[model samples]
Target: MEGFTLILLYLALPSLLFSAVKQILTWRKSLGSKPQFPGPRQFPLLGRVHDLPRYSLWLKFKEWADIYGPIYYTRVIDQTFIIVSDEKIAEELLVKRGHIYSGRPQIRSLIRHKEGPTYSALMDRHDIWKAQRKWAHAAVAEAYKHHFYGHVEREMRRYLGLLLLDPSRFLDYTREYCGRVMSRLAWDDATQGRANGDSADTTLHCMSVSGPITNTITPLWHLPAFANPWYRYEVRREREQRDWWLSNFRLAKDRMRRGELPGDTWAYRYFEQVKKEGNGDLNQTEEQEVFASCMIGFLNLVGVVTISGPLKFFLMAMGLHPEWQKKAQAEIDKVCGGRMPTIQDYAALPTVRACMKETVRWRSGVPLGVPHQAERDDEYRGVKIKKGTVVLACEWALNRVPSRYPDGDHFRPERWLEPGWPTYQEPLTRYPNFREGQAMHSFGWGRRTCLGQNLVDDETFVFAAAVLWAFDLAPKVCPRTGEPIPIDTQATNSHVILEPSPYKLDIKVRNAERGGQVLEGYREVMGELRL
Candidate 1:
């Protein structure tokens, strides 16, 4: 018995000693090699997880930026994060070093499901992501060349008419307009029927469910499946979402088989590409996956929700600051001459464009741009950033840099106008002769920049311009008090996409004749398109 006890002790001793040594080394590393960047004090093991705000996380991050400067480090659980609030540093890391920094963090909850691969934007830097991005960019560029803006213009007219009919349902109209336009861009036939009705709702639900869950409790992803029921639920939800997208794909495929393929639609283009090029380097499943992914991705993530927030914000801006609305309307009237605002008038309506720019800058839908993961261990400004560290381009902080945007919290369109105005440019790149600065980070930076930015910009400008041309948007008056209800610019729903909270706004046509003109324009556009 004594010999056996000794043998057991001998075996356990070495293993325990090894673990002790390893832990000591880890502790020393943690203690000796502290992060160079300043941040809130971190508790041992937990880091700043408890310090994080459950609601309005972006605002909290912005607050931290003010305290810790533009670049700071924080850890939640075992994951390290490098938050960048400055544009120059963001550009350096996310753009110039994009090859290494564009990798996406693994949110196991988001990708554990079978359909996870379909989320092209959330995908890690890999061959699959490259292929999906290539195909998506091509599809969007093709749609642009095919006069997709014409589709947007037509939809804006219809949207304006819907608002005129029921001003109270402006939110629904905005969301529905986005869905209808996306459906037209994705599947031309689907836009004419019931397909457009529930898509926006479905998309909103999917995002609302998945986004918060995936972002808030990412550490749970490390637990075994049996240990975490939430993981199982999300996986099931994702499967349903995958099925929805597949169903749409099948609808498009069936249409193709019957020789009813719609011209210039993304689905049609994809079908032809597969038939002609034989899926290129990808297998049939991958090809189908890419097609289905791009279709759903663009329709939901980019096409629908991305623009809805900005549209809502634009309306809120109009209601909150009637002066800016009047300025924009004047510009629209000058360029469009009482006719419906068109893309052709874009170059002439600088003030209208400036207003659009200011809306994006003031309250970006995506305040904290999507997280980018470090591909390899790197350093910035003498601060170490380990491989797999989550990098956040904190747009909420970046856009409100005090020097660039005075009274940054205030909604001011004039800041984007002449003389001392910021040099507003697309793609967020600096250029010579552009004086003040640029406000482009709302979309994102570098290789991970929003592929649909041009579409968003063009559509937003056109929609905003048309609405300003057609209506005098104002705050709703209280029937009891007879006082105008204050528009709370800060009253926004907390989500990955910050949307304007439900607010009452009185939307009226500038003139009764203008309402008739809008309806007539919608009829004429529909007739011309044979919709």
Candidate 2:
């Protein structure tokens, strides 16, 4: 009887000890004694869903940042959002700990046809994402090293010609210019035919329609087509977009097969590599999807929205502030003499660069930056962030931090030239040589920083310099009142991009002779290249 009792006690002791250790580990994994980060009051279950603004959500988040400090948590329904407005905290989490914070939240709208996965900017950080990014970065770098600037220069010349012919339709010209450049790079179609434009327009329209619907009724995406008409519509649009993309890939492949591959464009290079490597991870269908996804990423996601938004704002700025325009023009004239501004003139046109930087800082198209997801539970300072929590770097708020940017609200290009200007020095460094001022957050932060920054900087500088060198942008005169049209700086349209509301501006050629010289240069370049 004593032996049996001893055996029972020993077995019970082992079970008890195992249970005790499990509990301790669970406690450590839990929130424990961490203090709740300050934020707008949340209600039961629904959280702060009711409190969030529909339009200009970034502005509301900024207001909360003012009250709650830089790092604050907001819960919307079951979704946890950690907004980081402070640059240092952003750098620490997004850069230093990028391995954990680089994950992207599941946006159902972006997952076309509920397919396995597509490699686009919208994809979360994963093995496939890593592969896609590696290939994209390499491809873009190669393109840049080759003749990317030549493509840009040709497009810009075409843009200048269009602007000269119809200055009143400047926005249309800008959109077309961006579209053509991106389409040419992606598909090797410099003409930017109806098909390219239609594909881009369709993708944009689908995003515009589906983005808000998905946010409002996320669960609806999982429902059967019979249950939700909206989901049905979304799925149908996704199929259409996919078909269009696949068709383009097929066309490119056919061209490659015929040995008539258009210039060593992005798609041409991608197809060439596919033939060379024959990567086993991707089948023919998957390869097509990846190619199409990249095209959509560059053309619709990065190119059309970002490029056009800033160009509009720059034009508006020039119209509103002629003195700065004059300053930029003076620098351009001093640097380029009679020729149109080139990439070579970038260093000499510091004031023009300042204006470009200021335009980006003043009103970024992507005010909230892209959302990143937490891969696991983590703590920042004293606050707890759970796995899958959505993190926004809050570019709108960070750019306006008064402590870092003195007179942050005002648009002053000279501030970039002043001493001790705040600079970004965390995960990545931009404009290292520009010691006078801090770099702008327009491109974004950490590993998710814009891949096209180098291209954009060169393109924007050339565009701004050429425009300023040739034209004087001024407010259009009111027909009835014969007075200058009042421009409202605050008026903006918040879509995927933050665009200034339609406003009237007059673009007059500074010198007819200079404008003719620009056209002549365009003709000469085109003639020489036989483009």
Candidates in order, TM-scores: namely 0.86, 0.84
Candidate 1, residues 3-81, lDDT tens digits: the string is 3434443444544355446545766887866657888887655577666775567888999999999999887655678
Q: Rate the local accuracy (lDDT) of all candidates.
A: 0.71, 0.68
| Whole-model alpha-carbon lDDT for candidate 1 | 0.71
What is the TM-score (0 to 1) of candidate 1? 0.86
- Model 2 lowest lDDT segment of ten: 426-435
Each candidate's number of clashing pairs is 0, 0
Compose the digit string of candidate 2's lDDT tens values, residues 112-203. Answer: 41122343566766565566667777777677676474767777777776677789988777767776777677766655533454454455
TM-score of candidate 2 to 2 decimals: 0.84
List the lowest-lDDT window of 10 residues for candidate 1: 427-436
